[model samples]
Target: MNAFAPTRTSWRPRSLRWQVMAAVIAINLCAALAALVVIIANARRATEIEMLSSLAIGARFVQETVERIADEQGGTASLAQLPLHINGLRHVRIRIEDAQGNGIDLAPASHDEADGDADEVPDWFTALITVPPAERDIPVVENGRRIGEVRVAGEASDEIAEVWEDMTSLAVLALIVNIAILAALYLVLGRLLRPLKTLSQGLQELEEGRFDHRLPPPAFRELALLAERFNALGAALRLARDDNRRLNERLVQVQDDERRQIASELHDELGPCLFGLRANLESLERMTAYAPVASAAERVATMVDILDRIQGLNRRLLRRIRPMSLGHVPFAAVIADLVADFEAHSAGRRFDFVSEGLAEHYGDSIEITVFRCVQETVTNALRHGGARHISIELRHDAASGMLKMAVSDDGSGMRANALPGLGLIGIEERIGALGGRWHIGSTDPKGTRIDILIPLPPANVQAESAERTVIQ
Candidate 1:
C-alpha cells in the first residue's frame, strides 16, 4: 500500500439549529422536573397542615357535644348522634365506641361524588403527598362516670386529589407554551443564519478563480462586516490577477520582438555570406575538374557539400526563431506549412490540417501564441507520446467571436500520475494571459487530445472559405 494515497473517512455533521433546540429541550425538561419535585413537597406540607387543623376543629366540636349530652342526660345515646352530626365533615372521620369495645365507624364520603369523571391520582403521586394520620378522642360522661368516647381521625385523600388535578393542568399548559417557544426559535434562527449560505456561494466562486465576485451586505451587523471584508479582498485579488496578466503579456511581446530581431539579423547578415562561400566552392570544384589536380576536385566537392548542409541548417534555425511569412501570409497557410515541415522531417508519420472560417490574420500576440502552442504539442506527441498520426483543426465562429483549435494524436496517453512538463506549463500560461481556456485529455482507444478556445476581437472575426489539407 502506498503511504501517499489519500485516506477516506465517513463524517456526519450536526446542524447548529437542531443542536441548540436539543439543548433547550434538555434544560426545560430538567426545570420541569425540579418544579414538580418542589410542588409535590409543598403540597405534602400543606396537606399535613390542613389535616392537623381539621382534626383540631373536630376534636373541639366533639368535646362540646359530649359535654352537652352529659348535661342533657342522654349519655351514650347522644354519643351515637355525635357521629351523625359530623358525617359530612371534610378531611376527618368521626366514630363512637363504648366500654364493651362495641364501636360505630363513620368513614369519609366517596371522592367521586364531588370530582366527577376526573382521573384518579397515581399511586406514586399519592404516596409522595400523603400526610401522617392524626386522631383525637373526646370522653363522654353521665353523673360523673364515663360512658362512651367520640373519635375524630384526619384523612387527606381529598386534598391530595385536588393537588394532583392542579399539577396535571400546570404540566399541560407548560408543554404547550414550551412547544410554541421552540417553534418561534426555529424560524428566528433560520432567518439569522441565512447569510452563511450566501458566504458559502461566494467562497465557491473564489475557488473557481472568479476573484472579481463580490458578496452582498447582510442585514446582521457582524455578517455585514464580514461581507464588506470579503468584497475588499475580492477587489484586491482581481487587481493582482489583472496585473499578473498584463505582466505575462508584456514578457511574451518582448520575447517575440527579440526573436524577430534575431531572425532578421541572421537573414540579412549571414544569408549572403554563406551564399558567396557556396558559390566560390562550386566554381573551384568545376575549375579543378578540368585542371585534373590530385584530389583537388574531390576536396572541392566535399567543401561544397558541407556549405550546402550549413545553409540548410541556417534556414531551419531561422524558421524556428520566427516564421517570416506569419503576419504577411494567410494564417491557415502558415499553419499548413508548419504541419508539412513536421511531416517531411518525421519518417512514416501522417499529418492533417483542417481550417474553417479563418480570417486573414489575428493580432501578432494571438497568432504567435497559437503557433507556439501547436509547435509544442506536436513535438511532445512525437517525442514523448510516440505518436504516428497527428491532426490539427482550427475553427472560427464569427458570431461568437471565438477561435477554437483541437490537436489530436494516435499516441500513448499520458500517465495517470504524471505532472505536466515545462512545455505544457508555458502553453497554459500563454493561453490564460489571453483570457482563453484549454483542456488536455485522453482520446478514444488510446491517444492524447488537446483542445483550446480563445476569444477574438470583433474586428478579427472575418470568415474565410473552409479548406482541408492532408499530408501523408
Candidate 2:
C-alpha cells in the first residue's frame, strides 16, 4: 500500500490545532481560577459572619438573663443560684471572684488561685471583649461597670468545609478537561496545515531546476482551488517549453533546406561551367602541343590540378548540403563506408565497425539519424578526443524491437566541464525527435563513448526488396 493515502482532511496540521486549543483552554482555566478565588473568598467571609452572628445571639441571651436575675435578686446572686439562671445555655461558664481573687465552677480551678482575688479581668477575656464584630458589637454591662464579658467565636463550620472541598475538586477537574480539549485541538490544526507546507516545498523544488515535481491539491475547498491553479500553471509552462522546442527544430530544418538549395544550384550551374572550361583548356593544350612556349604547358598542368582540387571541394560541399543515402544500403556496409571515408580523410587514426543482428533496411530518417550520430562521434574523436583509434557498433534485437549504437574512441576524451558541441546537440535533437535516448561519456581510460538506443521502426520487407532491385 502507498504511504500518504489520499483523504479529504489529510491537509490538517495536528500539532498547531492542539496548541490553539490549549491556549483557549488555558485562558478559560485562568478565568475560572479567578472566579473560583472570588467565590471562595466571599464564601469564607459569609460563613464567618453567619457563625459570628449565631454566637453573638447566644451570648446576648445569656447576658440579658444573667442581668435580669441579678436585678430580681436585688443586684446579688448567690453562687448556688448562678447555675439555675445560666442553665440550658451552651455558652455559660461561671467564675465567681471575691475581693482577693477568683473561684470557678464544674471545671477544675487553676493552681495558684485564691478566693475572691480579683486583680482585674483575665487577659484572654479582655482581648475578646476588645475586638468588634464585622457588622455589630455585643455589650454586657452590670451596674454600669464592666466586670466580665461574653463574645462570639468559632466561625468555621463542617457544612462550609464540605462545600469548599467540593468546589476545589470541581475546579481541578475542569482544569484537566480543559488541557485535554486543547491538546486535541492542537493536533487537529497541525494536521490541517501539513499539506500547505508540502506545497511550498514543491514550489521551491520546481524553482531549483526540478520541473517535474508537481504540487498536489489540498483537502479543503479553498486550498484545493489554489492547488489546482498552481498545477494548471505548471502544465502551461510545460506546454510552452514544448512549443519553444518545436519552433527551434523548425528553424534548424529551414536552415538545412536553404543550404541544400544553395548546394544544388552550385552543383548544377558552377560545377558544369567549371567542367566545360577545363575541357576547353585541355583541348587548347592538345592544339598547342608543338607550338607553345615552355610556360604554357606548365600553366595548363597547374590549371588541371586546380580544377581537380575545386572538383573535390565541390563534392565535399555537396555532401554537407545533403547527407548520403544509407536507407537501402545494408547497415553493416554503410558503417564500413563511413569508416573508410574517415580513415582516408585523417591520418594517425584507424577505424573499426561492428554489426550484430542489424536490420536489412531501416527507414531513411532512422538511417540518417544513426549515420549522423556516428559521423559526429568520429569527427569529435579525431578533432577533440586526440584519438588513435575509433570504434562503432550497431546492434538490434528483433524480439524487443530495440536498436543500439555506440561509438568509442581510444583517445584523451572530454573534460568534465567541456561544453557540448553542435554535432552533439544535433545528435541529441535527432534522438529526441525519434523519442530515443542518447548519452555521451568517458568510455574507459583515455577514451570517450557515445551510446544511443531506440525502439526499431516496423520492417518493410517489400520496400527493401524493391530498393534492392533498383540498386542491382
Best lDDT among the predictions, by candidate number: 1
Q: Where is model 2 more than 4 Å wrong at Cα?
A: 1-229, 232-308, 460-472
What are the Cα lDDT values of the candidates? 0.81, 0.64
Q: How do the residues 262-336 of candidate 1 rate in per-residue lDDT, one tens digit apiece? A: 777667756765776677676676777585675565656666775766676666676777888789998888888
Error in Å for residue 303 of model 1: 16
Lowest lDDT sum, 10 consecutive residues, model 1, at 3-12
Q: lDDT tens digits, residues 30-85, model 2?
A: 88979766766666566566556656665666567667766887764344454455
lDDT of predicted model 2 = 0.64
Model 1 RMSD to the real structure?
18.4
Q: Candidates' TM-scores?
A: 0.52, 0.43
lDDT of 1 at 291: 59
